[model samples]
Target chain A: MHSDRAPLGLKVAAGLGLAFMHLPILLIFVYAFTTEDKSYQWPPPGLTLKWFAVTWGRPDVWQALWLSVKVASISTVIALVLGTLCAAAVSRTKFFGREVISLLVILPIALPGIITGISLRSAFNLADIPFSFWTIVLGHATFCVVVVYNNAVARFRRVSGSLVEASMDLGANSFQTFRYVILPNISTALLAGGMLAFALSFDEVIVTTFTAGQQQTLPIWMLEELVRPRERPVTNVVAMVVVLVTFLPILGAYYLTRGTDTVAGQGK
Target chain B: MTSAIRFSGVSRHYGDVRAVDNVDLDIAEGEFFAMLGPSGSGKTTSLRLIAGFERPTAGEIRIFGQVAQGIPPYRRNVNTVFQDYALFPHLNVRDNVAYGLMVAGQPKAQRHGAADGALEMVALTGYGDRKPSELSGGQRQRVALARALVNEPKALLLDEPLGALDLKLREQMQEELKSLQRSLGITFIFVTHDQGEALSMADRVAVFNEGRIVQIGAPETIYFRPETPFVADFVGSSNVLPPEFVAQLTGRKAHGALRPEAVHLSEQGHSATVRSVSFLGAATRIGIRIGDVPMTMLLPKSDTFPKVGDTVTVNWAAEDLHVMDRA
Candidate 1:
């Protein structure tokens, strides 16, 4: 291996950085099993499985979880359709203001979440559209589309233009060329983008807070529960579930994109 | 003979740049034709126009006596082997070869069998299951050939197909491609920038320069009797003597080209001093200067090589001189 090994000082700093990031999540997991119900206590006096039963029994928790799942799924589907089309247009063709259009597609994610939240809230009010489940889904899809488009555009650009031309030369129509040549080249990237979009939508809080006026997504529900602690340990258990839900897809997306970097006959 | 492909006043323009200016040309059925030119000289554009990848800005193209305006490439009865091979990375060799049949909605078994046969024709019969990435560069090139041949179009357009291979492999593939074209009896329209490749493989060649066809003839004629200064210089190494020099030698005030091989280092001829000598296996290329005009001569290698600054007389037959109008 030609890669140089990090010094002991750098390794120590990396270890400290990772612990600082993940230690709080570990704390959340630990407190979920704490016997104490009123407040968090370090190295809990006792441990029990009562919070699991308590979280399972809460109807509000189930409702919020279901709502979060529904919003993320719908948002992911919308993002995939809109993002792939936008990526194909921006990356494959030249037109007036094409650079401006690409910039606008990416602006939603690059801007602060609060700015996106406020803009979406004002737009909804201007249209007189009432806040509902679809409002939350639309809010999440704004940023979700950016994630999907970023992944798709990069992959589309990497796909050789000659491949499409060769397909047509081999007697394939535009649609057939897309089906045989273009789609296979971009499928993994699209899948990774869709997964990332889902994960982002599932855990979104800022935009959902403004657009979802009366709707209670899981993150919104957790925020509400944090303000009024009926059962503190139950909230910790729900936070554990949220972490697992978001982490799995992000991990899957990473693996999916890693395998796509070595496309056949690429760079030759 | 029926003309397999014809272009009448065809021109393709990109904004202000005319990639292929108005040109008229024809290729007979079962002829191995080549379009030879430098980059951006419109040879590839002409091939693309025939393949339906580019629409002619002005004029008409016909394939097998039918007008091909406004037709898409998929509907055209021609296939192209791209310079980069352009093999589908996600597909195995068999599926890549079967792509056209798949697009036509052929049954799986029939397409697979035909694909195998195409692979056999390219001498890659048992390598169908391999991915394009798994094969070597030369093998990948064969797969690309098989992919196009499986479609069995009336004409196969090869856009510098051997450009990516090394010189040795390129020479080997050139012969194989020629044999393949002969065996298939399909009109092959090959585009290349290499003059040697075009001359060696093509039955006839069209020499292109600045979006125009300067000359079209058999390889020997194109090399020996180029119609213009551009064809004379671009087709091979030639000393284009000034009209004054031609007038002095042949009593005609005209421009003429003399092949280096025709200029022999004789004991009594025009005296010139050798500037440089380079061995080329069976022959030696000697650069000489005569009357302030630099000339090249290819002489048979002998025991005593000519040293730089050695004065020698060069001569050639009048029949070897091809005269043209001054450009």
Candidate 2:
């Protein structure tokens, strides 16, 4: 219960915490404009925009970025369809082992990324499936579905059962009830979930590393460029772009879900 | 003439728990009917069954003499004003009221005109553009009623639609709903746990207890001539005389039920000592002990009300006493 004017100690601690989290990202932005061609330097000798032209000239960077966008978009679409259905089934009905099914759906995201990555890699090898774009999309969707399901299920539970019954009783069949009543209630949640799932899939690196065999997603390319330095500022510039691309949706999702808890006639 | 809605030997069970047990009822056309009961008393279950939200475990439900065994709610010619007034949050009042028509593929201009008419009926014509969240509780309730009535179904089911309002608003809405039903002349089947609500608004009320219809009759008949002890105690405040007590007083081995208002404070009859006196605005309720049996009597409020510890005599006309079997 801190007041509007927090204590001096708390204010300083909060500042330190934020700085700890964002200092490296700030450094990435600063280095993206630096003229340094080889290694990172404090106070970056001088700033220049030449790296933007060089990054744009690289076909490999374009390939990786396009691949990453494709994978995240397809993964998000898959997550939305499957996640909404799962949420509807879990929240709207009672069945045997429903809780177990919910637990299983969330387990992929809860487990360590390396474990998920390894399991996917081994499963792909055993099944004789090639490590391609579809494999990377599959790996990202495993966790993306969890994000969407979490948001959708919470909203579904909040929508009153009476709303659905009212729709049906007012001469709307099951399909119409979902379209008019259930859809309007859960639309914001589904949108927020989709945005969050897209953001999560965009910058994912560990899972992509295991699933991608000759293909390189944006994060994978950044890793390779870090190992072998050639026009180093280009990597930093690309990293800055990745940060912006992922940050916008996450921020948008936060605002979308902030006011979703208050539904009309819910308390009454 | 066909009954508006009929349930024949309907029994709905969830595993071993019987929600509605072998209930047979007939609601006449253009009559205001009420199913009155406490929580878990099968009243709400009966409403849902009629709405097609729940199927009966056995027997049949008929609408206008046609079997509604497998009919869905949308296909059945009835709409429900849900207890919580389940208005759509995303839509404004006009869109919410027009939803039933929109689903039926009515033209936009026709549905909008019909929605305005429905809103006007509820005295909410100017509130069309406002969201459900923007309306007050009473206003939202009217919108829900408008939404259901816009379809002009054969019968309308209301599941405690006034349960969420404050006391004053609830009383006001009760009168409004009764007058609205009269003007519409459509069959209304209402469900409520509040006996006062059922008594005030319904043409005939069904008293339910433990998954059975304990008694069904007009409000006056239910209050004065209850067929069972449960109905006698539930429909109103009544003194149910035990069989032994009745035998001692009337010299007959029978049970009796009498309303508190029926027993008046008198100069001579059955002698009793006043144990408690409660001043209830328009009336004074005096609790007394007549030999080992406790009884209550309601008397007109006056300056000469009896005080506790005072000895008094209470009397009732023979016609006021209702004979009933032991339950």
Give candidate 1 misplaced runs (Cα > 4 Å). A1-7
lDDT of each: 0.91, 0.92
Model 1 over residues B1-327: C-alpha lDDT tens digits? 999999999999999998999999999999999999999999999999999888999999999999999788999999999988989998999999999999999999999999999999888989989888888889889999999989989999999999889999999999999999998999999999999999999999999988988889999999999777788888897888888888898888887899999999777789999999999999999999888778898989789877998988888988998898747
Q: DockQ score of candidate 1?
A: 0.68
For candidate 1, list the clashing residue pairs, or say none. Answer: none
DockQ of each: 0.68, 0.70
Candidate 1 local lDDT, A43-67, one digit each (tens)? 7989999999989999999999999
- Residue A63 CA displacement from its true place in model 1, Å: 1.5
In order, what are the TM-scores of chain A for the candidates?
Answer: 0.95, 0.96
Model 2 Cα lDDT, one tens digit per residue, B81-182: 988888988888999999999999999999999999999999998899998888889998999999999999989999999998999999999999999999
Count of residue pairs whose backbone atoms collide, per candidate = 0, 0
